[model samples]
Target: DAGITQSPRHKVTETGTPVTLRCHQTENHRYMYWYRQDPGHGLRLIHYSYGVKDTDKGEVSDGYSVSRSKTEDFLLTLESATSSQTSVYFCAISESSRSGNTGELFFGEGSRLTVL
Candidate 1:
């Protein structure tokens, strides 16, 4: 397992508030990803970074932002958290996962956030 840590493992907040989730890794992998899990929709990507300061929005990026200032840290922020954003957020690290090259996604324990 990779050395990954997520802060504030559990949180409760009201609607229209802001929230930030931090992901730290010691594996020094080049790629890091943020995803949210919900019932029906399963797991959806919020954002990902390939390198320091190089990030791209994912399919479900609305109201969400991400930053990667260092190789081992990735930050995900919710500008204005809503009730619908309540879900378990996961931070994943991978060496590579494109084309013929196969890579495994190592996920953190997860951060559960609830909005009222």
Candidate 2:
């Protein structure tokens, strides 16, 4: 696919540290989101950015932040890593051609994180 790619597919971190994940897209999508996926909880949106330099907190924004200064890049940062944050993170892009709902998303392979 000619969509998006995430860096550092896997990571292991200690509690009380900092971590940042990168998401790069090729299609120059307008909507980008950073989400954490767990077994029981599915996907929890940490943050979402609509346009460049415009972002808002989502359902689970605590201890996490995001920035999108360019059209193709969005970064997610965990201020203080925690054991509870151990999960698979996914970056996704939403786009629509015919223009209805934008419909579905294309996701990166995902980044696995473990905190001990």
Top candidate on TM-score is: 1
Query: Which pairs, if any, clash in model 2?
Result: none
The lDDT of each candidate is: 0.93, 0.90
How well does candidate 1 score on lDDT at residue 36? 97
Clashing residue pairs in candidate 1 (N, C-alpha, C atoms within 3 angstroms): none
Per-model TM-score versus the true fold: 0.93, 0.92
- lDDT score for residue 4 of model 2: 95
Q: Write the per-residue lDDT of candidate 1 for residues 70-105, one digit (tens) a residue.
A: 999999999899999999999999985457325578
Give the poorly placed runs of model 1, Cα more than 4 Å off: 96-101
Off by over 4 Å in 2: 96-101
Q: Write the per-residue lDDT of candidate 2 for residues 21-86, one digit (tens) a residue.
A: 999999888889899999999899999888899999989999899999899999999889999999
